[model samples]
Target chain A: MADKVLMKGNQAIAEAAVQANCEFYAGYPITPQNEIPEYMSKRMYDLGRVFIQSESELAAINMVFGASAAGARAMTSSSSPGISLKQEGISYIAAAELPCVIVNMVRGGPGLGNISGAQSDYFQSTRGGGHGDYRLIVLAPSSVQEAYDLTMNAFDLADIYRNPVMILGDGYLGQMIEPLELKEYKKPANLPAKDWALTGCKGRKPHVVKTLYLIPPELLIKHNIHLQEKYGRIKKEFCLYEEAETKDAELIIVAYGIAARVCKGAVLKARKEGIKVGLLRPITLWPFPEKIISDLADKAKRFLVVEMSMGQMVDDVRLAVNGKKPVEFFGNAGGWMPSSDMILDKIKELKL
Target chain B: MAAIGTAEIVHAVNRGENLTFIFVNNAVYGMTGGQMAPTTMLGQKTTTTPYGRETKEAGYPLRVSEMLATLDGACYIERCAVNNAANVIKTKKAIKKAFQNQIDKKGFSIVEVLSQCPTNWGVTPIKSNEYIEKEMMKIFPLGVLKDKGN
Candidate 1:
């Protein structure tokens, strides 16, 4: 039987990564997400996993990138500001198509915004936050259990896609505690023959994985096109979302991560008030649930988008709605969280 | 020691090794109270050239990523601004890419992060970011210069 345990979202993610056989963890401590590295430092050391408190977020991410490229399951976690210090490495991993898991316990931002919860990074997480024509499989976990499950699955998806996977949550989710079930652990298969990885070439012909194409512009274009195809395939196959009361909902609430949790409460309140509101929570943020939103547009008359940031995800929702329904945005920036009553007021004001 | 030139970059790429180069472009020797660096922007005021960096006197801010991207071995090269929130996000992406490039064993990667030296710039952290945005980004626009395998 699966054992139930109460754990903070950050701790659950750390444990889940360990159970997934992640042997390498490199990161700098940052607010809300500090518990993750703090827990991993003690646990991974005992487990003989390589855990390093890096000099900076830059060094930590690079270390994890190096280990992961060597076919090791590796991970790193940081807050919004620290995560900003890591985009260079993230873009490189995306370009090289290496498998690694990165967690961003987002905080308020737009400088040193605040140490509070905010989803302002929605655009950065889903829309190739890093440079180049690359994409990360961004997963948004709404609960502690989901945080654990999504982190475990993030490694698998990174391997499956041969790309970096981002577990994007906010300070709320990172700091919150909830009941969780420790899932059975399994080791990743011997990394599929990756000739590109750097493992001191001994027997095999030396392999080089690089983004530099000193070749003709034509060649670079071809490489970019190839990456686009891969992204298209991912969009087709990896769009994960949950629909709550969407079937009979006249008003669909689209939210993600911690915002989704708040939306749930709002939905419940709205239901009691006789408002037919539903919830569309995105589990996979990158290959966003555009199709579901589009489908919902056909059935629902209104869509309300909520987030901790100042209307970042609202643009995506508008694109999905395509003017079929009125898509309204309700948000607070700089770590401010919307209460259930506040969201309910928005729903009432919108008359959705 | 490896000579600092194009040859070093080429050699690293041919061998498929990861290298990180942190280029501090303060336009002037910031530690020495704002003297000009090789990457100092033209017409910019530095302690060394308080009259403002004249085109003839200070030359131009070396667009490091642009030159580095020309190398075959460089996998990821980007210029980032570290002074503010919007720029901070861009800078973090650049940093992550540089590290990821090294780990992926995809040749050499470099991040030229524009940082503020309040003491040298004769300003506060707030004004430093403003100076970077208003003055620095004009010369070194933030973006990825080279992305081959990514």
Candidate 2:
């Protein structure tokens, strides 16, 4: 094991992205997530990699689009409002089926709400955050270590699927500091070469990366059907989550990201008081751990979902439980965070 | 050229990115059925402007080359026309120069070409060429607006 070093979560993500061999980075400044682009600017330059403090979030994502099309592992980072601006380009990238990583250190928002940790972007991120039927593999990291590890793995997953991957963090997760063991990034075995990338054709036929399929009306339909099949495979193969003390528990609290950390603390307090409570922390927000939750539904008496938004993930939780068990929710939005005591109080109210 | 992506033009120039932008100015929204565009000339008739375009309703024509020329990061900026064979050759040369500037890492280079759009302009193709030489050239002059590389 390597020696542990203390670092901020945002810096951990940036450094891990560098270790993942991200060749290009472009971003516009936004609060809570600015440290990522700031660190990437200096590090990428020193390493003689391409870095651009793009004109806007739109430009930044478009730059990522261009680099990914040209067979470079590219990345971009932003917050809520900035992420909204990149949606158009994100849709284009998804339609083109290019591989890249996008980081969203979420802050409060209906619009520029405030710069504080919030999980309000869950619906936006998991549901494709753009004008398309495509999906991004979204990873939610609760701790600095997980932030580092997941960011590194995100690149491999992107390349393997030839799709976009999103590292979904919050303001607290981005700014929080913790000791993390910096693991050396080893490339995963057998990632397919980006043969479809638009490098200029010398002898081989030219490859075109475009979204318009207007020749036959069914052309777009066929493309969309292919995309849906890819998504179905990802859903079947990749679903990551952590189960803590759930065996023979009466209440299982489902949570992710910063909210999950709080739930963990609450679950500990409940256990100390002789309450049979457990925690289910989802790491992958999309292709969400639906099967485990559905299986847990058989044993657990009820499930409580905690979040920093007004009950977004709870919908998925309900779908998974499917009336087999009672599913409940507790959440806040637009810059308010949940505490352990508040979550514990909510747990007690359930009378488990 | 459309008014969209104008912010990026200035942003890329300011960053001194080694990129080439070929701006085509046809004076109307050709694909969308002859609507008013930012570069639409004064008194030009389009779908949006049923009568002659008035200054109160629309604004003066935007000279993109002249606007970008003032930026210090711009290594080259030129406006040319492809109305005639000789002018077409000049436009090609301008485009080639812009790409060469990018290759030399000279910074942002742009070549704005005044093109003909007979469908949107409601004129014959020959009349469209004449329109570029006569009316469009008056607003968008043919020359190098900025050329630090030169």
Candidate 3:
């Protein structure tokens, strides 16, 4: 058994990244996630790793792009506003197919939102925050334990998929303190060699990484098709979810990240009162666990979608359920958390 | 390499220890079908600025090496024109020195080359070279902006 140590959520993710053998980390300081860059700043130098507190989020993401192009596990993290600034760079990384981990500890806002926890960036992270037909593998962590585990796994997943993978968390998920069972950093399953990396072309042909394919429009379309095929494969193979007491329930609640954590409590409370309720938590937000939701739609009479936003993931839930079941939404915004009472109230509001 | 914002370049110059940057300046957005760039000369006519850029409208061309030379971490900052045969030799020497500085681990260095963009400037290649030797040289003079070793 690995020794357990209590640590801040943000600090745990930073430590987990370090354990993942992250060769490079570049980030600009942003709220709730500042501890990540701070922890990396202190430890990376001693550990012979590269850490740069970049001038801005844009610069940080591009630096990660350059490092990742040179064949290293690189990462950059920011909050909502900072992540917004990194969108252009993220698009470039996606266009070039550079593998890197991007962490966004979501805080409130459409613009310059406050530095409190919020899940308002669900669509931003899942539905191509940047321009173009792109998809990032988005992971939602409900606890500090998942934060550590996901941060570590994010590096591997980023490499395996050769695309950016995001750890979509809120401020609370990054600030909460909890004991975590440390796992040894293992290399990702079936990570291919980065032979296409820009390694100076010393022994092979020079590798060029760019999004500009202008001489022939057809070439750009072909590149886009290639990327789309990869995304399709990801959708088919990399969907993950966790079901709690959903086997025999007639009514189910769907939530993710911290909302799920709080909603689970509400589901248990509803069960004790003889209300048939269960919870479905989607770990991977991009490949939104539609299979389970659609399958449960066959048995469950109603679905209550919970979020810390203005009804973002519910669109996907509705798409998955395909009108077979009544899909309802309960939202909270402006850094307000969805409490158990609120979720329970919403369940009762469904009147099933 | 054709057109880049100065923000990222400034940070890279000041923060990165051993990186050699070759900044090719053609005074216009050459790759983007000759749109006006931040480094377009005061009176240069780009596609975006069809009436010839005005001081009130477009400001002035940025001397990138001079701006970067202000940073303490910038080891070498040279602006050379590659217009004529003799100038080409000097420009090559400057580029070699920039790369050598990185290998020597001296510090960050950038060699801003005043090259010609014939297609974007809507001129013959020969005429573009002459433009670099004449118009471009006045706004962006060929000289070393900063050198830590010297």
Candidate 4:
């Protein structure tokens, strides 16, 4: 077994990315996520890899777009407000069908609220955070270990699906240190090369990889449907989640990221008190573990979704439950982290 | 080959090294329906600037070559108008120098070419060439704005 070293979530993500041989990284410095680019600056330069401290979030994502199209595993990282600026280039990355990884170590915000972890970006990360009809493989990491593991998975998933993959971590997760095994994971055998890359052709016809479908409505329609089909394949193959006491629990606490960790402790405490409370931690927030919740709703009495936002994922839980079970939400915003005690209080209040 | 956003070029060069840039400045947004560009001439009338770009409302034309020349990282920066054969020869030389600087690992180099947009300018090809000589040069002077080591 590989020995584990204590590491921050942000630094773990950077280490995992380099281990995965993602040779290009372009990013601007932002709060709570600065360690990512800072770590990359050193490691990438030591190995003679391409690393550009891009002008802004806009330039950073575009540089990622250029590098990914040029057949390099490339990425960028930012926090909440910065990610808003990246939405345009992210949309272009999707429209061009370029594979890359993006990380958002989220902070509290409608706009630059504070430099602390918050899960309000759930809607933005899971929903189409950019213009145009597209989807990102949004992976939410609950701890430093998952941060490292998912960062590697994100690269493979992006290349396998020919789509962007986002590793959504919060500020608390980025700053906290935990023991993580830096293992050399194997690449999936079925993953292939980027044959559609914009590498210059020497003996063959020059290839053009662009998103401009000006004429012929059917052409754009075909492209849109093709992307949807790819997303469908991803949904079928990559619906990931973790379960605890879901089989016989009366109330299942739905959460993800750090929010889920707090919920887990509360679930344990509630179970010791003879209450049948458990957790459903979603690993992939996009291909959202819908069937599991739907199936659990058939047997569970209720759901209590605790989050760090004003009740966003509660909507998804409600949709999954679909009136079969009562759904309730308790959240804290603007960097006010919810504690296990708060979640346990909510559990006691639910009395399911 | 087309003109890019000003910030995109300026910041990329300002932050990076060993890069080459060829900036095509036609004094207008040429292909995108003749709108105003950051390099649009002071009094030029375009689709957006119908009132000839009032100074109080719209700022003066941005001299991107001169602007980027101030940075220490910019190893070379030159502007040349290709309106005639003599200027075309000079533009070619400037273009070669910029690429050579990158090959020599001489930091960032940019060559801004003063091009003519005949259709967008609403003039004949000959008149458009003359326009660069008569109008564009007054605002955007043709010279080596900066060279770290001439």
In terms of lDDT, which candidate is strongest?
Answer: 2
Clashes of each: 32, 0, 0, 0
Q: What is the C-alpha lDDT of each candidate?
A: 0.81, 0.90, 0.86, 0.86
Q: What is candidate 1's lDDT per residue for A117-208, written digit by digit as tens?
A: 89999888887777888888999999999999999889888887788999999899989999999998764674456556788888778877
DockQ of 3: 0.02
Per-residue lDDT of model 2, residues A245-348, tens digit only: 89978999999999999899999999999999999999999989999999999999999999999889999999999999999999989888988999999999
True contacts kept of each: 0.00, 0.00, 0.00, 0.00
The C-alpha local distance difference test score for the whole of candidate 3 amounts to 0.86
List the TM values for chain B, per candidate. Answer: 0.81, 0.96, 0.93, 0.91
Give Cα distance to truth, residue A35, candidate 1, Å.
0.9
Better of 1 and 2 by TM-score: 2
**Which ten contiguous residues of candidate 1 chain B have the minimum total lDDT?**
B1-10
Which digits, one per residue and each the tens of the lDDT, describe model 4 over residues A1-352?
Answer: 8878989999999999998889999876677887787677668767878766554678889999999999999989999989988999999999999999999999999986888899999899888699889999999999899999999999999998889999999999999999999888789998888898888999878877798998888999999999999889888888899999888999999999999998999999988999998799999999999999999998889888888999888888898889998898899798979889988898998766
**Which sections of candidate 3 miss by over 4 Å?**
B1-150
Give candidate 1's error at residue A16 in angstroms: 0.4
Candidate 4 Cα misplacement greater than 4 A, ranges: B1-150
- What is candidate 2's TM-score against the reference? 0.72
Q: Model 3: how far is A14 from its true place, Å?
A: 0.8
DockQ of all predictions against the true structure, Cα-based:
0.02, 0.02, 0.02, 0.02
Better of 2 and 3 by lDDT: 2
Summarize candidate 3's per-residue lDDT along A28-74 as a digit string, tens digits: 66676877876776577668687765546777899998999999999
